[model samples]
Target: MQDIIGRIGMRKAALGVLALAGATILAALAYEHIGGYVPCELCYRQRWAYYIGIPAALVAALFVRSRPALAAGALAVVGMAFLLNTGLGIHHAGVEWGWWPGPAGCSGGVQVSTDTGALIESLRNGQTVRCDEPAFRFLGLSFAGWNAVISLGLAVLAGLGLQRFARRHLAAV
Candidate 1:
């Protein structure tokens, strides 16, 4: 495993990051649209890193041969993004598990409005998705838990790719 990881060049590493990030986002979308999982505010927020990292990874892959330093920088940035995302995932999972409180807006609670008009309006607006609840889970892990695991993996991959790229290309400079 170490030899295989060491052998992977910057371009391959970036491409691997791109592929994984893209697939993860696609699966999230599929879960929402096809699997009938309605995402909470935190769930939407969790996707931002993937949205940014995917393009960055692609650019890094494209430039790895011609501009190795720039590619390495992009990979570094992508790694940081994934690292932050991993934190967010953990926070969200904690919220779902009742380990910590989530944001007031999306956390589970019903606000009572004595005004009949406001109550009717809220009912018309449909249900509010709660961040403290998991829309789906497999085995013992919720979507947020799985996301934490995946984001950490991506971050490590990006770091490894950057390290390999730098050792191979930057050392010559």
Candidate 2:
């Protein structure tokens, strides 16, 4: 692990991880636009991690050469994003597997409003996508399941980046 870190350098690895997040986001968009898969509210929520991680990765990579402490902080944020995404992905997968219910808004539960006109408007503009249903599966894994797997991997990579930064900082000290 140390050899790999030394060979690649944390900055490059951070950039690579950021690119992976961006590519995954693009793939999600493609699945929605080109493959005609409509995203549920949970699906949209799952993307927040990647959206945040990409920018954090950029900052980490940029500052790693001159300001490693700052880079470490940014990498920590990236790790947290992926870690949070992993939990969310697991929850979404469980929802699809009937292990638990998703958010009321996306799980097909009807929300009653005191105002009839507001209720009527919500009904007209409400989301039709169901978070409990998997739009498609590959190798028996839903997209949420895949996201959990990928997010766990990203978390590990971020950990490695953090370790690298720590080692360098300690050595300098």
**Cα lDDT listed for each candidate:** 0.90, 0.87
Residue range 38-98, candidate 1, lDDT tens digits? 9999999999999899999988999987887788889988999999999999999999999
Off by over 4 Å in 2: 5-8, 111-120, 171-173
RMSD of each: 1.7, 2.2
The positional error of residue 83 in candidate 1, measured at the CA in angstroms, is: 0.7
RMSD of 2: 2.2
The number of the candidate with the highest lDDT is: 1
Tens digit of per-residue lDDT, candidate 2, span 42-75: 9999899998888998999999879888888888
Overlapping backbone residue pairs in candidate 2 total 0
Q: Which 10 consecutive residues of model 1 have the lowest summed lDDT?
A: 104-113
Candidate 1 wrongly placed segments (more than 4 Å): 169-173
